[model samples]
Target: MPLAKDRNTLRRDGVQFSDPVAADTLIFAGALVCLDASGNAVPGATSTTLKARGVAQEQVDNTGGAAGDLSVESRRGVFQFANSTSTDQITRADIGSECYIVDDQTVAKTSATNTRSVAGVIRDVDSNGVWVEI
Candidate 1:
């Protein structure tokens, strides 16, 4: 047979118990925590402790510009877009000095006037290269 013991009898002022009991035995300990009036953590309270398990932060790229038809030239050259007509061209230098466009589809540049679009998500970046989820 098993019996329930009072919390005060099991634990003294600041002492805990360390004993083995039968598999079917059961013991109930007092509630672990006390709450504040505003439902916030209270100081100098030792009932329950909160800890952060894991944390993660992400960097998002949100460079916005007017969507236009563009073309790629050379092997590692920047991007160029047509203004109004196909004959009128706008170079990357015309946009901004620090503006850089990346081709999301193909890793290798094939043609001088290749017209294409890429659809994917940036996976990660490192010293070697960038990884894309395509």
Candidate 2:
């Protein structure tokens, strides 16, 4: 069964699992990251770049003498992903709107000017941010 808003801790909070490793440098907390061709996580880049993956749950640095792959908590399934809005500015109507990957940590509500890859949908909106459900 699907979890309700109140009971959907995994949905609203994050139903995460540590799987993919960082493609290169370490990623910071709350950064909207994406997957590389190798299935490694990298900061969400432009539409012409990386594919939208998920919001990082925490930071991980596996480089610089670390011989192990850095793990990240990727939110899979239905979950809320918070991200900064682009220059377009977000509004309540943007809620339930389809957003696209703008940058490493940002999403845009409009694709009229840019034909970026679809990241997810804006399920909720705030002053300058939106909750995307991927």
lDDT values of the candidates?
0.22, 0.66
Candidate 2 stretches greater than 4 Å from native: 1-14, 64-68, 76-87, 112-115
Candidate 1's C-alpha runs over 4 A off are: 1-114
Cα-based lDDT at residue 120, candidate 1: 22
What tens digits encode model 2's per-residue C-alpha lDDT throughout 1-134? 86656663354544565656654567787777677666677767665546666777888765652322677786644334445444566677777777877675667766636766677777787654667776
TM-score to true structure, per model = 0.16, 0.65
**lDDT score at residue 34, model 2, on the 0-100 scale:** 77
Q: What lDDT is obtained when candidate 1 is compared to the true structure?
A: 0.22
Best candidate, TM-score = 2
